[model samples]
Target: MESTSCEKNNVVDALTAVEMLAALEQYRAELSEKDRVIADLRSRLEILEGVNHELQLQLGRFHDVLKPLTVQLTHNLQLSAGRHEQYALPTGGARLKRLAISAEPVDVGLQHTPAKKVPKNDV
Candidate 1:
């Protein structure tokens, strides 16, 4: 009876050991998968960071190029505004009224005449 009880305990212990081993293997597999995912994300993040840096550099260059143009445009606008007082530029409504008074009335029905098409001679 003592031997049989010892053998039962040994069998239970062996089964528990096998279960523990299987659980450990599963955990290791999950950890490996997580590590791979983290590595991939880090790689993508590095690429995006590089792209972002390049874009920032391009934006700086664009701003540098635009700065002089903006200054020139402001100067031009100031010059034009100064000239506006000397030039008698027509106002919008006055120009429209002048154009309307000068324009001739159009005959809508006789506006367009299509040319007659000659019949093809089938020789």
Candidate 2:
């Protein structure tokens, strides 16, 4: 009877050890899956950060290229505004004053004149 009891206890201990090993293997597989997910997320984040940095650089270059054009357009607009203001006034008074000071008589000319014939024998 003593020998039978010892054999039964040994069998139970062996079964418990097998269960523990199976549990350990399952835990290792879950940990590996979590690690793979973390690595993929990290890689994606790095790619996005690089793209964002490139976009910022491109935007800065665009602003630099447009800066001179914007300044030239503003200067041209100011000059045009000054010219418009000059032409907006009338020159009739100055013209009348100049005509009053002239001693020569004004003559009206014909709008269209007849064409004169050229002699072909002169060539």
Candidate 3:
């Protein structure tokens, strides 16, 4: 008769089993936490996308309303300037530049962001 060996039996040690269970529980907890964070980020992204769409709509409306005024202003400026050199002429001690400055607060309907400074010699 052939002798049977019991050493090859699949068995887990007590300490190793406990460690595996603990590791599995820890992994589950980490996964749950990651899932929650991902959900929050997705929600925030949706809100930001909505805000961006609204801003684009507002910008389109702004351009629509300002088109005529902008055309008229350009015509007047061209007439007064006569040539490119006269465009830099000072008015009331201030040069013709962007109205908003970096230090000024711009209203975005939700919060205020600092306006970017328009560099000199840039249109």
Which candidate has the top score in TM-score? 1
Candidate 1 residue pairs in clash (backbone atoms < 3 Å): none
**23-123 in candidate 1: lDDT tens per residue?**
99999999999999999999999999999999999999998788667756755786888743333333331331233352333766645655457778943
Comparing 1 with 2 on TM-score, the higher-scoring candidate is: 1
Ordered by lDDT, highest first, the candidates read 1, 2, 3
Off by over 4 Å in 1: 82-123
RMSD of 2: 19.2
Q: Name the lDDT of candidate 3.
A: 0.72
Winner on TM-score between 2 and 3 is 3
TM-score for all models, in order of appearance? 0.61, 0.49, 0.55
Model 1 scores worst on lDDT over the 10 consecutive residues at 90-99
Please list the C-alpha lDDT of all candidates, in the order they appear: 0.76, 0.73, 0.72
Give candidate 2's TM-score.
Answer: 0.49
Sorted on TM-score, best first, the list reads: 1, 3, 2
lDDT of 2 by residue, 18-117 (tens): 9999999999999999999999999999999999999999998897788667655655786878743233222322221121455343444533444468
The 10 consecutive residues of candidate 2 with the worst lDDT sum are 90-99
